[model samples]
Target: MPFLDRLQHWAALRPDANAVTIGAERLSYAELVDRASVRARELAGESSGGPTVLCRPNGLAFIVDFVAAVARTGTVAVLDPGWPALQRSAVERMLQGAGPSTPPAAAPADLRDGPSDSIFLYGFTSGTTALPKAFTRSRDSWQRAFATSAAWFELGADDRVLAPGPLSASLTLYALAETLSAGAAFHTLERVDVGDALDAVAHAGVTRIVAVPTVLRLLGERGLTSGVDAHALTGIVSAGARLDGATLASVRNWAPGATVFDYYGAAELSFVSARRLRPGEHRTGSPTAVGRPFPGVEVRVLDDAGRASAPGTTGTIFVRSRLVSAGYAWGDDGSAFARTGEWCTVGDRGHLDVAGELHVEGRLADMIVTSGSNVYPQEVEVTLLSGLGGAAAQVVVTGLADARRGTLLVAAVVEESGPDAPAVTRADLRTAAADLAAPKRPRGYYRITELPLTGAGKLSRRLLAAWITEGDPRVHRLD
Candidate 1:
């Protein structure tokens, strides 16, 4: 059965159980099913070929509508509610003439006959480009993801999941579905507020947190000051980006009793490699080591010839699993996902250790070949962040076209905040980056007021690359 059917089953099993909560509002399993049924009836009434665009902010309304659309087999496309008006308008214009018509009535038969292979979601990839790529997911793909996450994360009915990011983000959206499918209460904020999240954990008995590392770091910092009972948090899952050792240790210090997990995955490829951050597990191998493959998922580090590379050799990372998406929908960029026989790649460059642990270098397009050596910006950034201690606030390493070296490795630093913010110089950064090999260490350094960030709070390397190539007023040369 699909996710909604699983939810209905849970509703039948636990009608009065709390299904979802957002601040003061709470929905029991019965109420959730009823609301979704009403919404599904409305959606079923609609003409169903085209996708259903869910552009609303995160709340009970979005959840109900999403579930209803899924149940009615209307391909649900989630849009970032915080998208710029111009971008939103452009997408709206492109979709205006192609949307489905209204149906006469909600058909109950439509719900029962929907096949697992049928497309249910229109997920957009988070990119820095002008337009995002839309990808389709069959019910089975997400259903498989639900199972894998439940098993790997060891989720249960007793767990109360707190997903603090926007629901438009696939990580949080999958967390919502996974929480419901596991018959657990799902909690989220309409917008992420660290104070509100802490309150929920302290007062509302939120047991698990599914969030990006950046949000986790903020929560950890607050938890240190505010004093949250670590025992209240059962598990914390960090996704969307890699967590540096310092951030991981801070979160561990705050939630010592909770099992902290960080997974490396993309929207197109669901759950990939995941690792637990215990005390001694911090410095395992490479900073990029993201742990072993998820349950029932197979990964390969293949060279240009499409053969598996030797362990520790970087290559194109290919995934073969039912959890992969049904491929791109509208904007099949042709660069992201490529198929070779049975396996497919999402353009990520990574490798497997001799022990079979996956270590991600960076995105294939993001790799920088400078001074006759290939440098992964993530490796350089990780080294700088770790070596600099608290000196480096935020660091982005991007390659700029250079006349001498072909590509110049530049490190942009957002120095620590405050009147006593350490006056870091290019010399200091060069000395701090000594931990990295000669080739990987950044040659140029710039102290900036702010690091360019995506709307989703991720480091916008593309924007930084642009700012480096074409001068930006925000940047200051640290010569």
Candidate 2:
């Protein structure tokens, strides 16, 4: 069944059931569909055949308007609420002066279905250094993903889920749609507040959580100190970034009964691999492992010659699944995607272990070549995070231009506490990184008060590199 059709079916079957709740405003399944139908009809009347720009904040208004546009085949273009002024203005202009306006009514009982491959959403990539690239998604593409992820994660009608990030993010948006498709209640915050998120989970007894690692880390930190019974949560699914060992431990401690899921994928490719982290278990697989490939998803590590690489051999990661986006809608930066028949690769570098588990090396573009050896930053970053223990709040490993080694390995450390935090010296790092090869160790370290984060909430090494090189006043030289 189509994604929206599944939602409509749930509304009729469970009219009084809660569909979505934001702040104090709770909408039943029936009411949400009714409002969305009315808005969709309004949108249909004002249709100029251009994409509908949804730039509203996280709230009922955004949800209803978004559904309404989708129902009418209005070609929804979801923009980040925090977009810079220039990008917002340009996108709005491309929308041909048409905008979503509030209006009142309900969807027809019998709505006709359109071609499944019709462009439904212009999902933008969460790029921080440049304008977000707009990618296209068909109803069928995402619908297949919804079914696959729901079945893989054991999501069902009984799951009361909360996705605490802005719905603009693909991870959060998928969570919202997946919850609705499963006939479950979806909870979101108008703004991301740790206290409010905790209260919602405690008050409504949220059974599952879908958020990025940063949000999950904050929730876990607050949950542990607040003495809240987050044990009601049965699952915590984290994506959009790698989950460090420390954050994983903290999550397990806070939600003793919950299974923590950390996945590594991209916006263009919905889900690739994920593993369940249980209490008392620290290791899921290899340090760089992202777990086994998701059900119905095929993953291969291909070398330069387009042949599958041997196990434990790093190469460009390729994914084949219905979840792959229908390519970019507009900004087609030639290097972003490549195709080999039905299989597609987004330039992520990784390898498969002997157990067939995927180990994310890092992005191909982010790989640093130093002294005739290539280094994947994720490997170095993981080792440093584990070695620094709780003393390092966050650490980014990048390669700087060098006069001799081609590139110099540098680790930018953000200590947990401020400047008074215990210093993590080169000797400490060496001991912590004892398991890794010697060449991967950081040649120098910089202690910074804060780390820049991308729009998707992951640490932004690109921005950090620029800041350090340009002598951005915020970065302190500790080495």
Candidate 3:
């Protein structure tokens, strides 16, 4: 059941099949196998054989390097592509926890994080405050996670998978797995350009695409993904965050023939719940209806009593699956989260449907209690995106301290216009958020040309929290 074994198998079966594509570089199955084997041999005696770091730029070399490390060392640590040089240098220093054996052979460090963080994949996940909760995924956990996602997506040999999102993000790992496991062709924009992705699909005759909601938003904004011209594609598997109805409409319109499936998962939990939306059906950005337990996955929704909740009642989501994490690279955080029988969750809150669909509400930690009402920040943000002037694709809602309620919501947005552009205003945001409670409306607006995004390309709410907490002059982009 080893993951990379599939690549070796597929390469043997279909050595001539197109395995991966970058802008000017294409690697067939045989070529990929040959190259990765060579790269792995180059690292045979350099490190602990536990983890190697991947800090290279995106392209043929980066992908080959990561796969090679995973094949030989059984672990790969991925660094952010967008990390500033100084911060990257600091982070690299922190992640150098892996040490080579005595009489180390010649090799540059596989990937550098720093001295104490030899994790295969370690990054910070968003929380309510300015700090990102440290999260790590092991090689074993990632293989299981990718398998779970591939099963839900129903990957096949005929599928041509496109990861329009950042190739570095584990989300794109879904496509990489299919490339090897099922011998599907993997295509992605090396630089994450919008039209380039769509054109890649068309150019490659791609059938299936895996994209996060943000990339889908870009396609909508640029008219590249509307349904009117939907032809070569079969459908898209959406993850990372919930996809709302308005955005789904644009996705469907852009690729009319494609079925846009919604998946509810976190990097920790892997791919837990999913459902394929029929053409006539609607997806309202609710994470809840993500379908029932995946194959071999047992799910439970526990109320405060620790008892299973009614089908429609929301509670913390717990999953027992082959794909669950073995543990973190650092701490014992999974004790309360994972019990006997391999059950664990990333602290998502949602309820089970009568048909057994799993709908995610929000993270339990991000739930805001204002006037004793349990308010989900994501719900309020979705409402604002649908109703408010902040419908721009780059807005992210986060929680901050409030004198009255202890915690309040804040909005951070990106504009094509400069940060001083008058398109977004705190009052306009308030008016658009009127459907939500006064306590839930974002109290401030901060504008940046781009959201402080992680190397994985997820919005860095921790960074946004800092901006909101500082009450920086840039927070008043109201003008």
Candidate 4:
């Protein structure tokens, strides 16, 4: 079925039901359909093809703009509307090109490769893989994501879902569409302060929330977790990056009644695997394990030969699902990464445990080579946090330059609670990692006040590495 069909069906099926609520603004299914249709009509009148840069912030406008674009069969680039003006201006230049009078096409004319039979609203990966390729997301692909992923999260019509993160981020965009598919009310947050997010959720009477782990850390660090009285929340999902054991434990403790679903999925692949905290399960765990995939999804670990590896054998993870993205658009032709008829994976490295649960080690592209051994940043980050520093609020691990060793591992961390205000010395952390694999030990350490996060609140390793090398003037420095 097409994307608009889902929205139209929901609106017609339950017109009186509350469809959206955004900071004193509310809309029922009927109102949302009417408004969104008008938006669709407006966008359809404008242009030829490609994507419309969804320039609005993370609120009712973002949702309305997205729906309008989709209904018009025009692609949309969901960007962090809160990006620094310089960065945003750069994006505007890149996307919009020149002045409106002689404006370059929204997308390259040749960028359109898929069959013109049915065009769509695909998002571009921002400098993520191979210079930010575009994913040609068909209407069927994204709609199935809403249909199937709903069962994985167990969303229902009565649920009030909140995507507090920016609408420009893929996760929030998917959550927005999926919530509507399940016939649930979606609440939009214009601002993302920890206090404001908590209050917004409470005010909206939100039952489910999808956010990155960084937001949880900020909420925990700011002490807003203690003040929030959002008893209505049933589930809180933390994704994008691994959540430290202590950080995960604290969030669970803060919202004792709510179930926490920590997931790991790549943008190229839809929902890879998720672990929802059950009643008796431990809250604090090694972040490596992201648990099992949803029912319809299939995961395989392939060696360098692209052949399936034995259980517990670490290799690249390839996912198969109808909901997964189609091949990315490149110069002239599109390239499919490890894909079959209905599945595709974004080069994540992992292995399945004896229990058949998936444990994502790291991104294959992010693997660090030091001396003779290859290092996975996720493993090192977990190691540094668990052994050396002992539960830092946030940690980003990557490879650093070295003339002698070729390349060395480096870790940047932030402490949530410590008398030093920044505890966990670099020497201590390195010594800890060295105990496990000294050859691949981190040579540099830095304490940052506020870690840079992507639009979806995930830690940006690119920015983290740049900060360590350039010596972030804003953060306290320690070499």
Candidate models: Cα lDDT each:
0.79, 0.79, 0.65, 0.68
Model 3, 2-102: lDDT tens per residue?
A: 34566767777888998988776889987987776667667656664334667665688887776666542345656656655665665555556543322
User: After aligning candidate 1 to the native by TM-score, how far in Å is the CA of 172 from where it should be?
Assistant: 0.4
Lowest lDDT 10-residue stretch of candidate 3: 108-117
**Model 1 pairs in collision:** 45-103, 46-103
Each candidate structure's TM-score, on Cα atoms with residue i matched to residue i, is: 0.89, 0.89, 0.79, 0.86
Candidate 2 segments exceeding 4 Å error: 93-107, 110-113, 278-284, 368-374, 389-393, 399-409, 416-422, 430-443, 466-474
Q: lDDT by residue for model 4 over 261-350, one digit each (tens)?
A: 877776777777877885346754446888788667888888889788898899888888776665565421323355655546677788
Model 1 Cα shift for residue 232 (angstroms): 0.4
The better candidate by TM-score, 1 or 3, is 1
Could you report the Cα RMSD, in angstroms, for every candidate shown? Answer: 3.3, 3.5, 6.0, 5.4
Backbone atom clashes (below 3 Å) for every candidate: 2, 0, 27, 0
Compared to the true structure, candidate 4 yields what TM-score? 0.86
- Candidate 3 stretches with Cα past 4 Å from truth are 48-50, 84-151, 225-229, 279-288, 334-341, 368-374, 385-395, 401-406, 411-438, 445-455, 463-479
lDDT score, candidate 4, position 75: 62
